[model samples]
Target chain A: MSAAMTQASSQAMSHAATDKRCDVSVKDVEISFGRHVVLEKLSLDIAQSEFIVLLGPSGCGKSTLLNAISGLLDVNAGQIWIGGRNVTWEEPKDRGIAMVFQSYALYPRMSVRENMSFGLRVAGMPANEIQKRVADAATMLKITELLDRKPSQLSGGQRQRVAIGRALVRDAGVYLFDEPLSNLDAQLRAELRVEIKRLHQRLRATMIYVTHDQIEALTLADRIAVMKDRVIQQLDTPQKIYREPVNRFVASFVGSPAMNFMPGRVERGATGATFSLGDLSIPIQGYPFKSPGLTGAAVLGIRPEHVLSGAEAGPNAFNAQVEMAEPMGADTLVWCRTPSGASFSVRVDSGPSIAPGDTLPVSFPVGTLSLFEEGPDGRRL
Target chain B: MLAIRPRLASRLAAWVALSPALAVLVVVYIGCTTWTIWISMTASRMLPSSNFVGLRQYEALFANERWTVSVSNLVIFGTMFMIASLALGFLLAVAIDQRVRAENLLRSIFLYPFSMSFVVTGLVWQWVLNPTFGIERIGKNLGFADFKFDWIVRQDMVIYCLVFAAVWHAAGLVMAIMLAGLRGIDEDIWKAARVDGLPTWRVYVSIVVPMMGASFATASVLMATSVVRLYDLSVAMTNGGPGIASEVPAKFVMDHLFERQNIGLATAAATSMLITVAAVVGPFLYWQSRRRAAAGAH
Candidate 1:
């Protein structure tokens, strides 16, 4: 009897582990529209309750990947698994997934109640059950008061709330959002972004969100998959992606006022590897390198914030003439040209009074630098 | 004072710009309509006379069997033609919307009949539906000796033949309108509907059709106007044939005015049509304007 009990417990433990595993998996998905390939052998695995954001610029296959996962688009060749079931051949309705569109895509003629309950009604759920689900979702979204109004009558934020409610009522294993906040104003987008984050925390449902907005990705995602040219460039936590991007493209794409790229080369010597540009050679003693013996014609990347200002400058400090100063409320962005003729930008506190042609002493820290090989691939060195 | 002077001058210029349209509306539409109403109350037969007749012609019009049959035929034709055109047009639009190849060619082919005048459409259909030489002869040539497609001559079914011809000509216009509506819909809406698990038909009926209220209204209103003024098709196809089985109200008015030389009865019939149209359309126009005003206010 004890042995049987132990066997049952082992089986239960295995089931729990499976439950904690990836709830949605796309394996080698290839999608094409006629002669144009949107995604090539794209694969992604989303753990149970993990909020993953697919972040990229326009035409970068992020939304296409989301559509493929939701079964809204057919793959040329691949498999998709959701909740341990292969749903590659399934219709979108049968895939245990719900989606929110960038336009909200609410039925303009129907009341919010009808919009939220339409899927349930289509699935032939009972009337009372549909009512219960819609009510629960409406309450969760705080849109119960707007249930009687049509989509045209609601504000943009309210309509999106009802859209989220429509997806929530499905009780699906996965939720897909394709730029759901792109159509909103900045204030509403920020407000709803927080709401979506709160929603993920409460429900813990696996969600795959697509957006070109890096701020949205950084704020709302547990992990971000940065995509470019139909392939994921890097998939990691937002902090890791921000601090240690896999390539020059990912680094430039994620940060605002983007990371400055200076043409340079890496030279290895007795002291350490040094990044040299014109006459400026900065030692890379404390820099992290994904691979060793990094000596090449490379490009050095330094974010605007990483350029130290004021009295923090040490021995390696150099003076650069300011070409432009943009006051952005919280900080002033000072664009200057280095002695090596490289244009560099530094973000300083608003209290500093700086002007164009004013030379400021700034130091490049070794810790926060990103070095990439100068080639077509632009891989990190 | 300077701003007010310029505003007053612009207002005068606005009046000047609108004078031509106002003149046409008054002289052509309202003036002619008023004259017709006045002429309906007279006892004119060969020519309009000033002899006032108090609703006598209307009573005579209602008493005429041909007039009664014409009225009933219009109801049947209007209902059948409008419903069939809308249904067939919506279906065609949906079919073509399936990302079909050669879409421009198909759309042009479907819309070709609408480009033709109704008189030409009616004449072409008359030849194609001729029992002795058209489909009947073709069927017999194919060795089906007992085949009969003589609805064009049958009294009870001649109205249906007219309906078929009318639908053939008008369904294309309806299809074009519906296709425009379908195209105007956001592509993301379809994606959302699919993710919601709604069937294609349900999406059309519940979501898409309701969203296309303006398109349907435009198609139906155009169809309704044609139904009321259905003279040319009747004359060309059936010509009130099989002993007045396919006679329509407009044809009845035309025949009484010219061939029968009964101007009193014709004017009475025309006046009745005008009143009926006004009765139906007036309230609708008022409601539409009121709704627009409310919307604008909001």
Candidate 2:
């Protein structure tokens, strides 16, 4: 095995063995709307003070699961426990949680201070205590100067900060965020993304955020629950999720430019399994197989960055004609067709001046390739 | 150059399209208003005359007992109808917004009264409020001999009967406006309030109602205009009533101008009504515009 592959797997193994204290547990939850089942017997366990992001495409039931955890939705059959208490039927306020919404959801007529203090007042907290909590949250979110302004008077990012402040003032055990940064522009979104990470670090509170943005999931989550078709496909640390997705759906969903899949058949030899595509044979010597002696019709998945070029190639090298090269400031994406006529892309440093019609040698490391059974299920082999 | 010419041509076409409306405003609205003021200053009765009378007609108008009762009746009726309709409409809107089944049907039923003309509304209510044959008669027939619902006939309480009918006719329209406002609210606000542990009533009172200022303004302004022009209902229901107990300003003007043949007094009363409306509405409009400007500035 290559040294880099061994190091990556060892790191993922260490992340899995850190802690097991479950602060929030959703067990056998079933949710449906009329005739449509949103979540069917779904279960998840979130560690205390861990930022767990529910990542999926739209309509993948990630937000619905978050709502169920927040007690905003009632499950047909399941139990939700928070801090050792079963809160299956508890009111959202009594569930020891606070939430931020995609639209900010600030009271338009209320000042920022009032927005942050409203829940405390509703809970019958003393006025002075409410004032202190509001002050602390406002200062934490850096919205002290905006406390007197109505939400309509504040900029979009400022309004979102106030929304986060509203949740922070609740001082609850868990904080829920539902696509809170989706409404902002790219620059503001990146700025607030960093601030949310910083806030999570400072508060050390259990937070479950939902978004379709994989960048947000990768940067903000201690662990991500990647969902599709009303069930979580994989739940693991972000590195593990990216490096070793459990199924084809998760393999394609969590990466930029997506992992490329080449249809092939796994051939069993005396030494190891080799994947064959058209007329080209690629060795799969050190590939970790979930099942031993994995031999059958299979597909090989390679990330664009993993397709090394020039002298970085170690073995299994082949020549391909470049069809196009797109320079993207820091890097260039070269779209090429293999000698056997299979198309794929290679992400290389921008230092290379390679153009279309040029031939370049690229290597696909067997240690980094994701092999899946060629079928409707497409489970990783 | 081509783009500039097309833009100028569109601008000229827009002006040409708006000219008819401008001419109508100048001739029909401003011209009629000026002519009425001029007639109010002159001593004209049954025919237009050139003799100037000035404030003499105003003096006579203030001294008239029926006119005094009409003005006071308007004050009571307007205040009661506006407040009651707004409260009832807002309540109906809130109830309907609770994801009720058959919502479209209920909304249509509530707003059905607004579709009828005031004359029809007044006539229909006149039968329902006829003490001898309405609730009083029904109660007596049901074996209660002392049942009394004769507000339409009572001298001191006749105006309240008018208020009840006006509220019924107008509250439905208010409900439709309030419903639209309520629907425009983000669904997330309700979820936030729920998470805040706010009682449903408190949420409506503190958060939802304050957000519906525009809807309330629209409903109140419509009610105010109806109050100022409260002639057809009085005419159809009670015809200024027994002993003119249900008299209103518009009825007074109509009676003086056509029935009593007192054009001079009628024009004076019309001019007074116009001034009263302007006095109340002008400052309100100015305040609203200023508030809008302040919000825009931020």
Candidate 3:
């Protein structure tokens, strides 16, 4: 199923590559309320039919940026362009965009059909066209049976689907989603996340999504813009963002169970640079360094899956005393203390049956390690 | 058994807490209503007399032209007040919700009239509507010599003047209730409407107003009760002037009960009012409960 979906998405993406008119450009946008600054000098360019996710914590200005692009918010300074037309002064509807909000925002008194077709009706579209568009959107959302029902009669997932249907009926060049699935339960969130990915692949519309969920960002975005403190920390493909976060904030935020950090020092010696924690030293000869020959007061960061244990430890392995084990169905997350007294976790396959207090030989693969300068802003080394 | 004990103890506590309210409902409300209904069926002049006269007081009350006029005036006042107040109040709420400056001050200013008693409000409006010294004279002084603002004294238009004053006094309370409802609505809905290209008035009329069914119901109920009990406003403003043009049901019952020394007719009018109120409220309460049950079922 996954392979087929990816194949379909790739085909749709290539097909969508031809439509360059829908590209969106946000130029030097600054948004502020009174004395508090929410976003300043933010700029981004989205290609036609691209699925771009703005990933950030709450109050990080991700949703604010989305709102600015949608023309629902007025930027204090800057121009927003959709399809080469400056839409900064235009109303949201005239900007050729549709948005799905976190709260669903479905009109409670309107039926699913009415909710989806309201925009067309307001635009003075003919009755037959409105009916056809409503029908098409309802079918696309698989809510044809629920078209006559009110939003109050639907479940959270169903209401969100109706909201998406409302946006779909617009047939606008750009689509904006502001944490649309955050109100759903875990199971429903996962379900809708996959559905949204599929819908993006099928529609191939220029979609900008805002989410705090890294999993959603990773799974849905063609490119993820990780933001912090009203600034874009990193913007890259999901793989690149996961493998090469530009700074500590992006690095710590983009992964689940999070990357482990050890306060260590990179010393430049006659035998090349080596990272030393307490008495344990590891050569970082193969690691990619942004600034080579630089040393001292650095932090070594490694994901749980990057640490190998037992037979896979290879040569030059260190013994780690196991602290606890949490079995998560397919794998076990074992918390352990290194010989240097640094605490970290390892993701071992369920077959290993690791337990607390067990001493395991684990090796850090130097190629996958991320070394950062130790300070408040932990820029990559 | 332990669970039952705590449950019973909590139930007893609830009953104990409700005892005073229950006593008032029984002794003051139900007892007086029962005695009034009984007295309406008897030949009671100034005091209670057990000479049974079935439906005679009601016949007399219906035949009385003043009581008839009072009933019709109430219907007009009730209909006009309910619509005008709700419309004006809802508009005021929508206007205030536009992120305006001095919103709290504006809200308090709008709501100030409701804080005053109806008699005070009526007296204030009486001076304002008085032809010689009020708006008519002010208009004439302002150089419009043909201005004729005399609705308060004109017999055919006097009830409307009462309606105007009452709406002015009560629309603020309705505004407060409707404003609360407007605030309770999710802000995202407005954004969605804007994205849908809905005009502001269209959104209020089609979406926002429909969503505030509970607010409308609450405001209407309060206004309806005031309509049924409208006596002080008329007394203070016009005192059934211009040949009983502004007489209301409550004032009729009051005059018959004390000033006219006709307790039987007064009780009869009061009983008719009780029945009329029940007739309107019964179906409304039933429909509300039914809607609630239907909502819960889904």
Candidate 4:
């Protein structure tokens, strides 16, 4: 038994290494449900073995884009190319892809082993080859003991693991995940998130994951595509997306405690441009403006963590009064109003005892502030 | 001591609450059953007379040609009706589950026949299958001069007419139950199956049908009980006519009890039916409970 178990595990470990990985390219795909267009002219190119996340709020077409890529939903126009093959008109199975659903949609009556091998069996693969693939997937998922158990017999996490194993057994070119962790509880969600990251690292397969949760997008994705209102706002590395959001929606949709915005006007001077908030004017000398001579009504955006207070708020700091403090274990978020009467939050270390109604000196560093045009689109300036 | 008093008082209240149902069980159900069994053993004709006779009524009941025809006819009708209704109902449910247009209207239309009484169904089918004015006449009127659809008048084929009407009446109910089962399946399961490259029919047979055990059990049990109590339809439609071809066990018992005044044989036939139903239902109920226990263990 021990020898057989070792052989099975070794065979399982050796499987993913030899599997072929493929890049996916969605070229200007448009999808609509009747007249309600969910995605319009969306195009994205994902590299081989890269982990790409489509992140947005509900109804932002993140899941719709993922479905179009997986061929679960048809696109109205444009072609999808996977590994250089145009598979826009192909069925989901013919497109050489596998998918994991949020609800862990394992066949309720089948045991885990049968669930994993169902696709292969339907494709008329040899029985022994199907068995070997199922065994390898079960071993890799640490569900060998659960192979004989029905989905209803397993907990939520175990069921999701089996669902992943079911997708894994397909050994397809690209894998799609449609909010697979949303149904799990928080603790299990965190554990499975780490496991998925590790699985991607080991397998080096192209994966397209869709989720509204920013933490999962940041932690698991090699590139994050922040989408909103039927369009992709930005597609970049997680660090770049976080620090250099292209618009107001992308900045506000990502990050916990969200970026703060203060409406102000920028006036051109002989020295340079200055952002004037009430009576106080801050110099925008070294700031990278999209247009060098741009001067108009603009919004100054700053993350809570980038705001400085107390000793770090030196002589050039602005004055503010604390409104309320929200204690979040690692750091306390202090809500404050500047002397110009604009309200914002500052992230301060929990050690300092900041309270409501306390006067403090706060500063916004020139390097970290984002300037946006004041009207609706709020394009970065 | 205080707790014991409350417990005793609550027990008294419980017994008070349960007395009506308990009285009905003992007086109506068990009481009538025992009295019928006892009467089957005694020779009672026209009037009640307690004279012992050892299985004589049963022996005569089996020997009688009409009773034999009734029993055999019941077996054939029961088999055909159950199979036809279950298959047709499952198919109807599958068609409706394909995200069809006006689903609510279609479901109501399909289930409309079940809401009607069996006698109404039998009368409608009786007129529709009457060779002179029904399909045969219509076919002849519409230009087929040699059409002959007269199953209701033929002895060998009359049971099939009964099967047809009974299926039309009961298939709607089974469809409703199976439709509910189909709706309970997760939409994601269908997506997964499509991604798995399984044909739609294979998924329905291998995955969807197996998962609908409870719906099948409910529909089958209801159909089985209706099969046992199948008297009104035959009386309303055929009246066991055409030389007593479509005669059933319930009709046999009813005719002997009320019209023929052969109480002993009627009671005997009724007892035999009761035994047969118990034989089929006992194992079925046992299996259901065992399955429930097994599921609960998980």
lDDT (0 to 1) per candidate: 0.89, 0.88, 0.90, 0.89
TM-score of 3: 0.95
Off by over 4 Å in 2: A1-22, A375-377, B1-16
Ranking by lDDT: 3, 4, 1, 2
The residue-by-residue lDDT of candidate 3 on B75-176, one tens digit each, is: 999999999999999999989999899999999999999999989998999999999999999999999999999999899999999999999999889999
Q: Is the docking of candidate 3 incorrect, acceptable, medium or high quality?
A: high
Model 3 ranges with Cα > 4 A deviation:
A1-20, B1-18
Clashing pairs in 3: none
Q: What is the lDDT of residue B109 in candidate 4?
A: 88
Query: Model 2 scores what on Cα lDDT?
Result: 0.88
Candidates in order, TM-scores: namely 0.93, 0.94, 0.95, 0.91
CAPRI-wise, candidate 4 is medium
How much is A218 displaced in model 1, in angstroms? 1.1
Ranking by DockQ: 3, 1, 2, 4
lDDT string, candidate 4, A50-152, tens digits: 9999999899899888888888889999889988899999999888788999999999999998899887887877677778878877877899999999898
* TM-score of model number 3, chain B: 0.94
lDDT of 1 by residue, A1-381 (tens): 334323433432223222333399999999999999888888888889899999998999998888888888889999999888998989998887889999999999999999998887877776766787778778878998999999999999999999999998776668899999999999999999999998887777788999999999999999999998898999999999998888989999998889988988888888888888889878888677877876778988889999987777688888888999999999999999988899989999989699998889888898888888785458777
DockQ computed for model 4 against the true two-chain complex using alpha carbons = 0.76
Model 1 sits at an interface RMSD, in angstroms, of 0.7
**lDDT of residue A268 for candidate 1:** 88
lDDT for position B65 in model 2: 94
Q: Best TM-score goes to which candidate?
A: 3
